[model samples]
Target: MIMPRGSDQLLLPVNPFFIALTLLLAFAFMLLPFGRHPALPDLLAVVLVFWTVHQPRRVGVGLGFCFGLLLDVHQGALLGQHALAYSLLAYAAISAHRRLLWFGVVEQALQIAPLFFAAHLVSLLVGLAAGGMFPGWWMFLAPVIEALAWPLVTIALLAPQRRAPDPDENRPL
Candidate 1:
């Protein structure tokens, strides 16, 4: 199997527990007292999308839906608003996963920007349809910030898997 020029070395199999832990941590971050600022990034969305792309079989639309529901309950927003947005986001990420992996991290971030925007747009539209007031143009900033955080999140999340499995001195993988 000839590796692509832009691709990194093979990653270790992702641990399910780590995936869950990261998702929960992101959700907890979301629950913090961020004061409902429209411009605030959705860390959960970014992590969810990351896992969905990198481990689609393990973390798919169902997890996204469940977490989104949890967020809705916590935030007191329209019941299915986040759920719908996250489901669509996960689906999109899964669909793009293969093609996305061929790019460098920065290019991957550029490609993912639209998915974040679409998720936010879905949430915004759902809110508007539910008689919620528009959150102003600043709302768009959330997706941009989320996109910007993609590389950092990718590095942090993939760090554990990047280590050599055996770490033999002469066996450079």
Candidate 2:
């Protein structure tokens, strides 16, 4: 039997391609010009929240930070804004990950919603702090959409490793 819950527990192995593909897809989603709302979904943040919960070691602060900075270059946002938000979100994910797995998909989505919101909030906060003009209150709208999108994001993120759960191993309480 697998040992009680811990980092040592057998995690579903997440392939590097999973990470790369998700990030690339997320980048593309962001790069596509927005409609008329002046709001863009937090695609990278959604992916980070997913991996952080499902596979903390595979998706982490450095990855989040780099992705954020890369986003900065791609989207023409401030250089460090996304980097800080992503790193913070990663740290939060690792710390809360153990508790999150116990919750149902809906519950987990509720939990990560704020992390998604906060990551973007931090980005906006940093932008304002850095002398960038404050985006409209509508900028906050993306998080709401992001939170609603979490379930799909989780499925998309985990689809790469969708083997049935190990029958022999104990399920979480």
Candidate 3:
């Protein structure tokens, strides 16, 4: 629904408390034990996509870079590796927002998953160029995991935003 005068959209504001809580959650996600798996998916990436596409006014490239840097620190990977990927993801999401919205969940997953794959590839190339060691085939699990969760998470988390505006608010301007 369109917000009334002086009322803001549903996007959450970026405040100190929000930043701190976000950092805490990011850290926890990176460190939480999950039976020797890499969480089978990038929860952090999913989060970035959600905010970037739906509430871009609140979350944009800078925040993606910030979160990616935090993830880099937590994962002990090359700094700026994930940051680049994350910011790129945000850009892609914002650019493709129109096409993405019109597609069904299944169709959207097929499309977005490739972008996720490309992001992973870009990160891998950067790491290699920087002389960072490879983590081997198991690392490829990321895209597959990304593919599986991309649609489910988006549909579950952001579908609310697609709902029609409350009809009673209609009025001639």
Which residue ranges in model 3 land beyond 4 Å of their true spot? 1-27, 33-39, 159-173
Q: Give candidate 1's error at residue 114 in angstroms.
A: 0.8
| Candidate 2 residue pairs in clash (backbone atoms < 3 Å) | none
Which ranges in model 1 have alpha carbons more than 4 Å from their true place? 1-7
lDDT of 2 by residue, 1-173 (tens): 65665633344667888787887788788777775363667777888778777778788899989988888897788898889998999999999999998987789878887887888789888888888887788887888788888888777666646664655555552
Which candidate's lDDT is highest? 1
Q: For candidate 3, lDDT tens digit of each residue in 25-61? A: 6457856666435325677776677567666677788
RMSD, one per candidate, in order: 1.9, 5.0, 6.3
Q: What is the lDDT of residue 84 in candidate 1?
A: 97
| 42 Cα displacement, candidate 3 (Å) | 1.3
Clashing pairs in 1: none
On lDDT, the stronger of 1 and 2 is: 1
Q: Select the stronger candidate by lDDT from 1 and 3.
A: 1
Candidate 1, position 35, lDDT:
99
In candidate 1, how many Å is residue 125 off?
0.8
lDDT of 2: 0.79
Ranking by lDDT: 1, 2, 3
lDDT of 2 at 81: 86
State, as a TM-score between 0 and 1, how close model 3 is to the true structure. Answer: 0.72
lDDT of 2 at 166: 54
- Candidate 1 residue 60 Cα shift, in angstroms, is 0.3
